[model samples]
Target: MWAKLVPGKAVATPVISYMLNKAFTYLVNYWRTEDMESVKAELLKMLPHVQAVFDAVDWDNIKEQSAALDAWLWQLRDAVEEAEDSLDELDYHRLKEEVKARDEQEASGSVSKLKGKLIRKLTKHVPKNGMLKRLKESVEGLHKALLV
Candidate 1:
């Protein structure tokens, strides 16, 4: 995915759009249930700053005239990539927990097993504090990059 960001290409819009989509999906699915409200809210808050930064710059012009601006853009891109990776990690853990719950339910051979065990198992896999901290930091980094 990072390879798609060629220096002079019009990559910002697509990358930002994709990140927005992923963030929204997480908000819808996990925001309240997974105790990720703060992290998700911070992410939601930062995204507009990101969009504004992208909007404020004429990247094509900067590509030709300013090596420093090019470097800044790369920094912003790296932040976005980091944020995306954090979201991907959250999704991976969520899916892994779901599959584990399903396997446990099947092994138990009781449909009723799902009601309690699945919820408990799913909650157990809520992103650890370290993961949440990393995600929050990634979003904060992106916000800081936008300020630059």
Candidate 2:
């Protein structure tokens, strides 16, 4: 992976890598799916606020007192790790649906009408309401916490 290309412990790489991974995983699994798209769109809309908070973090100042912020950092790290895992699960479900769709399509012969129907089903993935709500709440919480 790019991890080898990019040195570990580099100042900006970790943040960039983490954000890219999260965005990529989310989009790969949910991009065209209407229900997930709406949720993803909403999250995208809130990125500016999140970016603002991220921009406000003073790494230089934190480094001087890293020990003091250890507990706070740990909490933030845990939250981020949980969020990443949740997002990655989207790909799992997507892959599962892909397999099921393939199986269904294979069982149905190569008729043009059936192919069209298969395409439609493949495109219309159901959204996970709870996950979407949780994601929105998590983003809102971040916005609020950063505001304080």
Candidate 3:
């Protein structure tokens, strides 16, 4: 159902959790079954409402920042592809090993490790003035979503 609609990533986790829990609770409590048609209709309605809310949020550079991030990711992907294309067999294996070690470390950096790093990063990046208030609002949102 959610796959058919678009919502801000900020709201996505909460909305998915809420809907899943609600639907599961309903089924368990009443032993009722649901059809996809009804779910699809609900999803259709939700998409527009979500669009409206996000549209109303006048973020100055959020879109530009997200696009820049996307561009950087694309550049990284292209560089990796180009490097792969240029690699000779022995060099490819060496690069593969290097990548494998990095990937392994990344895989080991679980949610707890990520959170610790994030806290340290926030301490470094977060400025005073209204920025902290905005940060607090963002944290409050995730907290209410049971995500942070």
Ranking by TM-score: 1, 2, 3
- Per-candidate clashes come to 0, 0, 0
TM-score of each: 0.64, 0.51, 0.20
Best by the lDDT measure = 1
Candidate 3: tens digits of C-alpha lDDT, residues 1-148: 2122223545643453454344333333333334333543454345444445345543444445476434433343343233233223223444665565456557765875576556544543222334323322332232232210
**Can you write out model 1's per-residue Cα lDDT over 111-146, one digit (the tens) per residue?**
668575867756766666565566656766775676
Better of 1 and 2 by lDDT: 1
Question: Mind sharing the TM-score for model 2?
Answer: 0.51
User: Where does model 3 exceed 4 Å of error?
Assistant: 1-9, 35-41, 48-52, 57-148
Please tell me which model should have the higher lDDT, number 2 or number 3.
2
Model 1 spans > 4 angstroms off = 1-11, 14-64, 111-118, 121-125
User: How does each model score on lDDT?
Assistant: 0.65, 0.51, 0.40
